[model samples]
Target: MIGSSTGPLTPSRVLIVDLPGPDLTPDQGRLLRQSGFGGVCLFARNFSTEKRTARLVSDIRDALGPHALIATDQEGGAVLRRLDVPMPPSPLALGVLDSEDAAREAGRIAARGLLDLGINWNFAPCLDVNVNTANPVIGERSFGHDPETVARLGVAWALGSEEAGVMASVKHFPGHGDTSQDSHLTLPTVDKPRSELERTEWLPFRRAVQAGVGSVMTAHILYPALDPDAPATLSPAVLSGLLRLDWGYDGVIVTDATDMHAIADRYPAGAAAPLALSAGADTVLSCGHGDMETHTDHRQALLSALREGRLSEARVHGACARLDRAVNRFPGVPAPYTADQRSLDTAQVQRWAEQALTWVGIPPRLDPALPLLLIAPISAPVGGPYGDSLSGAHLATLLKEIYPHLHTVLHDDHDPTAALSLLDRFPGIPVLLATTGRWSLTELPRFLASRLRKEQRSALHLVLWNADQAAELKLPSLISHGFRPANLQALAQALMALR
Candidate 1:
């Protein structure tokens, strides 16, 4: 029946979909085998260890057929989906080196990690230019604020991934870096005109396209200049007219998760799926099917749109063709997956971390003989795919290995009770504050920092994670612009020298 007279049932338009869990359940297996399904996208929850995740990837491919594209957001730093091993330094860390070769080497290491796990598609090389300091997201994720620098680093990263036989998808096009809102929670608006985007925002994406990157993911934010009514993920003028026609990007056009509040708040999957496809998106990335009924309903909606002439056969076939072509460009990883540490040079990564780190006000000369108190905030906003709340605990553990006498306290900066408890317990000691992202000063961390200063105790703040959150926080500070193990290690070494 799948390959029968039914048209929509054959060669599904939706590409890079998600399963319910890590293992291939019966329902998921059937969905994978369905003619209307395209491929798979994995997340942190789907991974346990390197070898286990590799086995899971292999198992999915075996179930869905070898040609099925396996993809994940392997971008180093805060967006890494794989939890088994240490992620490479963030793109901003590489950008600090001002070396295209370093960016390429970092990209190669990231792609090779994915390839060894049998993944062929990596959603990485975030090309968003960090032009706005108040941007809620896309901070250290971006290479830098300069368009030329962003373009050069982005191209090197994309080229490196492709050269390593993995498809690199330059993302959040045309750009999501200038907005103050996060698309995952609300709809972020960019007021720039097409001319402005061409000058600043579009520079990195243009370079990646010219470099023969295999895919491009659309931004979920609204740009009135591009399309007044709809977001770019569902805008014909932006995706088809600009990206497909004018820019001539023949690679697969994947959408940011439609389930995200930016789109899902207004359009349900039944409606959003068809609109995205009609807007020239080659794939609708929907995570968590919810139930069999919901999945069936979504499939039927696309089929109905095609049959009723709402979405033509030509458009569906065109999308499918692009996906097939992208798939064919990159071969799958060899069998018997093993995460060999030799594949990545940890020493080189540490060296890069050291170069990328930036320090502002001088670190206080704390007594190395006395115990040091490290207070850190580690929580992500609701609904984000990345940003673990316990990330600081891991960083603290890594630091303790170097400074065995270091005392680490992990608490939510948003909770006054938690902050007060930690402050009351560790009074009079020189406290080191470590925070992750833009939300660092939201309520808890900001309150705690003020309280620490009012008490006239020695407090030194460090931007251990997202560097852009460094805006407006007047404190003697240090920043790594990344949270990887190597980055943490680099921070420890710097602290030791300051002591």
Candidate 2:
């Protein structure tokens, strides 16, 4: 427990670090430890194989010691951290199955996978109730549009983490699903009344608290009804008064990536740390800009703010206590954190992928004999090893194998214009298989629908391989839970049925 402090305090608990990637160096770890940062987040970019990732994690742990918190954004589907390893279907995919057992199993698989890699903290089980289809960030990364559904699945995911001796961080507190803008580049404001938020946005978070989630991540979006002046990450009323006081969440409170333009673009990095602390965030995730110079400067600024009495020492200690408790609870036993390849040999992945594809709706009569165009956007460049290149290529290859005679054309571009260009080649074609990268088809060219309508295609088979895109394109499309090669058989089957 953290004791109350009447005066200023030092900056001892700050979760300032970036997602480890190919670019991360051993010297960076030493500098982070020396700078008094709390932990580092891992991305697929830092890992090519399970064994290599495990070794990297072990190295980071050895350098940071037991007090440091090593975390990752392993929320499955579009946000998965470990691409080389086997993971369960995305939350939306699970939502289609609508089985609590499946959701729990997904949590278990995810937890075990992370634990094997020496990751103690997971920024996952996004509790944001995705009410808006246009929501650029949350989209299919969320469980579903319904709060109750999100809560049920979120609890299952959290429980799995705790059972596996890993800490689960339920994220984007107060909800971020309704906003149309991306918080990464702008500050999204929720205009809904407090009552609406209570009913929809805050429902999943409340359930997460009841389920005893180990951590909660604050959203950068501003809610006018809650606090017009500041975003949730810097608002005491939103974090302390609502999340802590009213909701009674005793676990660690972490801020979303502070380097995101939503927060960073608005406030000075130095000024935001203390404000976040005072607002009840126990950990501050800084996954972007991992330079030692920026880290040191930010650290000093936070420390000086505490020393100068701008921020309360009690809040700092309170945050540190929660972080310390989390670190202490991490499983210390060493296990094989590397992927063995054999572990992913199970038929369950194939079954689930097929099930998800079916739930997304592929036309019943997809002619395997006809030429099929597999159109999907290129995964974001910043996604590292988990980018669309790996998953996209895997899916394309799988489709080719499943439909040996099916003529396939692969386009990596995400722009609607690019898709339109490809569509021109298949004028008047009745069958089409489309997957819109990470972005939704709704956000794509409205003319695509016009072209489809003009083509009078009744057998258009569209599939969203990305969950975030799946949530927005509800036009009877098939969804691949995760973009794995295992989904190829299902895609082929669905396409063949379209005949």
Candidate 3:
């Protein structure tokens, strides 16, 4: 795209920054206008209420432009940032439902909600096939274990969002599902042969490119099968040679957040910024330590690289051109794309979620007469995505909606004495250990479940995400594969009807 007729290279055009707070200050607005920035990535801190979110978007649009891309990880399951708009079941839940129609509708629902908040990009339809149940980060974020299934549903979801006027991007490309570790914590490697990767990790992404997905986000993990040295985010073979040349993918390539320890601990903002762009990434996600100057540093990093000749001028132009094309293709509107909030079809979404409840081994049809005590893990929130946040008030409200009469004991694994002692009050009641599914896969619930079983009290697991791994615990478990209230509603409804 940098061939002959593209705009001049600029830092703002290729950087999607994260803000410190929900409100954009006057100084920040001035900086944005001056930089002529490309986009903003919203986080959980950005949305306290719909009114405030609307005002934030209004100010952002005023500072940047109507066409400036607004993106967020509203992937509709575990990683939903906005509570005001009810999201449909997660990707894995949709996969379990096995309905292309539902998956597409879910995407449409997610896009419409984001569009209402003036966001144009949904960094979603995680194309990773969840082959490894031990994987801490990917789990329910992925579609399923089957590559083709993931591809089919991912394409459906992508089209649903794109057709709704918000662009959907398939992410953590070349795959993050097989890795046992979280890339946010450290560098992870997918050590498999190229042939093995072809059948597994590469299949869904290849299908996404064929389906005309407008963008692909690179994983920070190393793929020694593809490149011996750098991770996918900074590997030319993975990005340019494999994705662009061999696969013929002509979409914008985005890097995972450079702030993550996988990259940040290794490379500085200035170095990683140029390296990522040079490696064929069209945009660098540099969500610096929650400040305007973090973005300012990254902007200067790219400009400095250009001045220093560390990065090619043509490469910068090309990246900017690809990003601009994507922006033009899926521009953010000034106001809500859908007329009414009812357009989200909450009932229909719930129906799909209901069908996603899956069982491992025999269905633990606990007697409805048994007193139920819900035991959940509690811990400080982890810094990156897919962490310990799900066991909080959101989980409680949803669990309450489904099982009104249920009692709960929130426990930290460090001191299970408080929770275990509470469990004694229930006597012979069945214990429902709710996890952030695998996100809260600490020993707390397992230990408590073992303790309950030892006491001859019945124990059943109602995992809120990653049903694929429920079999690992050898407990009669139900996996919703989604963390939303709708997901819990489905699991509760299934168990209730079973009796």
Top candidate by lDDT = 3
* Tens-digit lDDT string for candidate 3 (227-297): 98999999999999999999999998988898888998898754688889889998888786476777877
How far out, in Å, is residue 222 in model 2?
0.6
Give the alpha carbon lDDT tens digit for every residue of 218-337 in model 2.
Answer: 989999998999999999999999988998889989888777788888776556777888788887776554354655656776787778887776678777777777777774345454
The candidate, 1 or 3, that scores higher on lDDT is 3
lDDT, residue 47, model 2: 60
Error of 2 at 317 (Å): 1.7
Cα misplacement distance, residue 170 of candidate 2 (Å): 0.5
lDDT of each: 0.77, 0.69, 0.78
Model 1's alpha-carbon lDDT is: 0.77
Candidate 1: which pairs clash? 413-444
Worst 10 residues of 3 by lDDT: 1-10
- Model 3: C-alpha RMSD to truth? 3.0
TM-scores for all candidates? 0.90, 0.86, 0.90
Measured over all alpha carbons after superposition, the RMSD of each candidate to the real structure, in angstroms, is 3.2, 4.0, 3.0
- Candidates 1 and 2 compared by lDDT, better number: 1
Q: How well is each residue in 332-445 modelled by candidate 1, as lDDT tens digits? A: 664332345533456678889899889877667766777778877665452364645336677777767666778877776555675566667767888788776545367666
Candidate 3 C-alpha error for residue 156, in Å: 1.2
RMSD score of candidate 1 (Å): 3.2
